[model samples]
Target: MTTEDTSIEQNDDELFEHHAFTVDKGQAPLRIDKYLMNRIENATRNKIQTAAKGGSIYVNDTPVKQNYKVKPFDQIRVLFEHPPYEYLLTPENIPLDIVYEDDELLVLNKPAGMVVHPGHGNYSGTLINALVYHFENLPNNSSERPGLVHRIDKDTSGLLVVAKTEESMTHLSKQFFDKTSEREYIAIVWGNVTEDEGTIEGHIGRHPKNRLQNTVFEGDDIDKGKAAITHYKVIERLGYVTLVSCKLETGRTHQIRVHMKHIGHTLFNDERYGGDRILKGTTFSKYKQFVENCFRVLPRQALHAKTLGFKHPKTGKQLSFDSPVPDDMQQCIEKWRHYAKHQDAK
Candidate 1:
């Protein structure tokens, strides 16, 4: 048993949390750095690599590097610098839409327009806040962010998983590594897709000149991006806009929206990517009215996480959940469909 040592006190700036976690097969045999990347939410491989090289990572009491292989039963220690908020604020109750719940995990249908967590310039109304509030007794992914196993965009409503226990979080996260997790989304695009089904395979990376946009390039470096694959089927073609079911082959930030835009079909009302043409409502009254009335151009990308499936981390049970499109998106589709039909009749 380790003895308490509060005699050595640290200042606010000096007190970084040291996390201890066990390695299971979900983490075994992979490069120690990537394994750490797999185990932690939002922590990347580069972060782990830097920590290992800087002696902030220890496996069984020895500092290791990227080459170290994780093994079951190994006690991994990570000394990561937690921001000042870690110890200062406990997670508070924020209302959340719970889709499914078990002892090990909880699946939430996060509404569009809720930030996943509090970050720079954002101090309130985030998914993590809700997780913390709801799972008040549950441990966090680390000491800072509470319970989040994965995320969806603030304005993209869909299924998200929060781990109730550390072991479950670790195991479920590896499914993402093995590409076994089932993630499906629904998106409304600006143009109709003639093809009933198709796949867009592109190398997606940061924009060359426009830092905010994602670009698909053919060059070898391709900016060293992950090969992003999106399998999409036209679910409903409303003459102008279309509802598409998107199955993610690889998960990336802003993936579906960017990939669709790359294929000349940005999401309906994506001001950032589609610019003028998609947004200009010369005569679509319902859309124009919405823009001019209650909601402005501020609606989020019309993407929804309709389904997510994965094996239970502790029990290995195949778990799946599905949700209908939200009311706003439903109204958008119906209004667009009516306008398209009227235009066609003319």
Candidate 2:
């Protein structure tokens, strides 16, 4: 059986997906776009050509144009900053940590490292695949993402709700759109936030240079981005890191991460936003080694989607759910507590 190699990579705030395929011996020469269309589900010619123009398409490990012909036994690869929409979704029996389930909707805690839905290089083993396999006739709002009202990042563990019917999907979506739903996140960020409570207001949009990241914009240019607001309160104080609870007013892509970074407290271990490095702390070798050990314990961003509240679509009753911080993050926090106490003694 032929196997395709796929990897998702991020570098210097740039996101890229890598896909490699080997052509069959009997394959005939064909335009690269056409060839990809036949091989990659839901890939349109325009999208393929755009990627080619962006230097994201490759053949035999070399960049190629959309018209580059594919020959028999040739190696084909493609790289893109974003995952294209997936056309086909196959259900898989992946276990889910379902928090609550009713006829109208179901709430579940999404673990870290599990994609909320399939896209780009992630075609399977997603929450959507598991939901489809476990339930019947979940609603899709004219999109591939079925029953989703909103989405959290794949690496951020959290609570999410999925609609079981169209009415529920519409109602829940409207609630999110109107900003009536309540969502709270627990995050550990570098640097001790000076304020006990504060609100972060910014116009958030894609970074001008890095397509993989979002940034805060202001003044006339602020009109180019969406308005985003995050209200945060200090939860705990570690020596070099502060734990904060963030509540969203307007949900934009990476809103919390961007807003926090704009305020000079990047989420701990959030490599995409430059938090993985030693942003705050002394340059001593022992301090550096301690930070490295903490990084090893928590490999992803120190954020958790801890609480969600919304009115039920069917019953008009309020519903809420909460999830504890996962083990990795908890352990990392404990280590920091010990280190901070040790430092205070010196």
Candidate 3:
């Protein structure tokens, strides 16, 4: 048997685990689930059955039931919502801004500077830590992270939904994976976007030179990255900077920051993507000092996950939530507004 394993990262934080196998020509017929159990490490018959029930197991591109017999040379594929957790989670009694809650799921407004889940060097003070503490028996996404469905950057404040039950986790994850969920972000970026609105399309992947950053790949190198689409419209112009609303068609790590920068409008104060150094303003010392002050006020990247919408896992009702811009971003925007007004008056 030839086997191939793949793990794909989706929607910034969602991870999909994929496995493919080609049956040997001489292989005897066996139940697909049992066949997978023998080939995949640590896979249980129950887990394989669950994957089949979710229609995540395929035979020759067609979803198959657990009882289906694997014929000789048949192609088989399996998909899991997430991978195994890398860290042992410790529940912390951290405060959560619960926006809305029900028996099946809950929505919370995550503040900036908070990590979504425990990871290398950030094992504590994460949203997951807080979640496990506040709630009991929260369903683990395939990754073993309890309650988490999706995530934003550590510094991007926004609304996120957490599943309280296994059914909810499966349902909500399907919505996000199918691109039926809606997510919108508000950002303050350097430069006056020449167009009132536009769509940015490019493949996003890790930078070749900088391991910490993600960059856009175009032309012949497009295959090097994942396809990403961002639709942006100007909300307000602030002279050297602009406030914009970005709707994501596809979510990738640093999609907004990378796509905006690709168009010459790096997010204001985005230190990772080079927005912290006044990429758009004048060289005058006074102007330089003003930009520096704005940077200090915002402190992090000027991006926020402002809105989230999804279908209720059980009820099938469409639910949407919006978050107000945080105070630091508000204050920084005000400063730029004043600066823009002053420049126009001159």
Computed on alpha carbons, the lDDT of every model, listed in order, comes to: 0.72, 0.85, 0.86
Off by over 4 Å in 2: 1-85
lDDT of 3 at 225: 97
Off by over 4 Å in 3: 1-86
Candidate 2 has what TM-score? Answer: 0.78
Comparing 1 with 2 on lDDT, the higher-scoring candidate is 2
Poorest 10 consecutive residues by lDDT, candidate 2? 1-10
Candidate 1 wrong stretches, greater than 4 Å: 1-90, 137-144, 275-298
lDDT of 2: 0.85
Ranking by lDDT: 3, 2, 1
lDDT tens digits by residue: candidate 2, 195-250: 99999999998765444678999987897688999999998899999989999989
Clashes of each: 3, 0, 0
Candidate 1 C-alpha lDDT tens digits along 1-346 = 0111112123443324345666654433768776655445456678778878887676786778888887877877665455423333446677777878889998888888788876433556777766666666665663345676667777788898888887887787778767799999998887767789999988887654343466787777675467889999988887667889999988877889888888778887665576324443467666666444313432667889999999999888899999999988887777767767887899
Q: What is the lDDT of candidate 1?
A: 0.72
